[model samples]
Target: MAKLLALFAAGPLAALAAEPATVAPLTNSGIAGQLVQLLLGLGLVIGLIFLLAWLMRRVQQIGPRGGQVIKLVASQSLGPRDRLVLVQVGTEQILLGLTPGQITPLHVLKEPVPLADAEVATPEFAQRLMELLGKDQKDKP
Candidate 1:
């Protein structure tokens, strides 16, 4: 009978009767802070990656095509029906021709002009060619 009374005295019901329930820890403000931080970090990283990709694409778009590009150095009008253009591309110089509806390659020069031989900032021939090309735009009508 004494043992039964001791067991009853030590019961969880008696403990609960003595003290109210203690509240649990708040737990990181209910996961909202962590979730927001995770989402913010993910967005930042993805935005940066997309920005880098867009920058690379813009850089590629502004530059020339891969391998080599041809440059026209000079040209001449030959006869009434033929037109000639002197072109220099990398290590070779070539003469291209236009005759009515047909196009032809006239010659390939042995020596190419060195980059130092011409001033890029003030190229008279190139300027004239650009003017001629601009004039062609008006003639199209």
Candidate 2:
């Protein structure tokens, strides 16, 4: 059985070895076409990667907004590790004080504050920058 299998395998191998092998000579046009094909394949892979990344970002952005029952309306830093966060639950807004040690409930608002009203206080850096810009404009001849 071993000899029979070996003979069968050698039969094809012997025929292939006896046959004259044809080697296609490389041409400039052939090489250029192969290079173009390689470049196109590389571009396709890169474009697919970018498309997946963009799809992931869009999916992540859409995921959070749709499923959120509780939303943070505003946040203010009281100290280095302490913060006041106002969150809207259903129609009620609750103010929470957060520290490194614990989270505390501060107050529940009777009327929901408009989102625009919450950002009324300008940041200190922004205020100072505006002041400097105003001074520069005033000094300009």
Candidate 3:
């Protein structure tokens, strides 16, 4: 076991002793060239990061734009992690119950309301309250 340990230690030492030491002296031009390469590489990485960030911003601004049929009418927060959302698909309006884990359909309108007549964009608080009460009345006998 001692002989095996000595052999293992000697193997690395022998290899190191056998290796030729060829040290090239650093010149000013070689140093300058290396510095230029390093600067260019760093600049390329920074520029790529900036480009990706800009692309992400532009994508966020342009959000889901290709022939989108569903439009969000309104959203009300029920709790910290729960919400009621009114979404319009074509002419039909759907009430959705949203939670942290799942989305559920709370109600679906039988009579489809026209988007132009619905005043969905900027509905007054009184108007919206009346509409909700009217909808509740319709649901009951």
Best by lDDT: 2
lDDT of 3 by residue, 46-125 (tens): 99999999999998879777768998877899999999998989778999999999999999989754556433343477
Residue 117 miss distance in model 3 (angstroms): 11
Query: Per-residue lDDT tens digits of candidate 2, residues 1-141?
Result: 999999998999999999999998866678789999999999999999999999999988976677688988899999999999999998999999999999999999999998785345667887688787775323435
Q: List the candidate 2 regions with Cα displacement exceeding 4 Å.
A: 1-42, 61-68, 100-102, 117-141
lDDT sort, best first: 2, 3, 1
TM-score of each: 0.34, 0.45, 0.50
Q: Which runs of model 1 end up more than 4 angstroms from their true locations?
A: 1-68, 79-81, 113-141
| TM-score: model 2 vs. ground truth | 0.45
Candidate 1 has an lDDT of 0.78
Number of backbone collisions per candidate: 0, 0, 0
| Deviation of model 2 at 15, angstroms | 22
lDDT of each: 0.78, 0.88, 0.83
Q: After superposition, how far is residue 7 of candidate 1 from its true place, in Å?
A: 97
Could you arrange the candidates by TM-score from highest to lowest? 3, 2, 1
lDDT of 1 at 1: 100
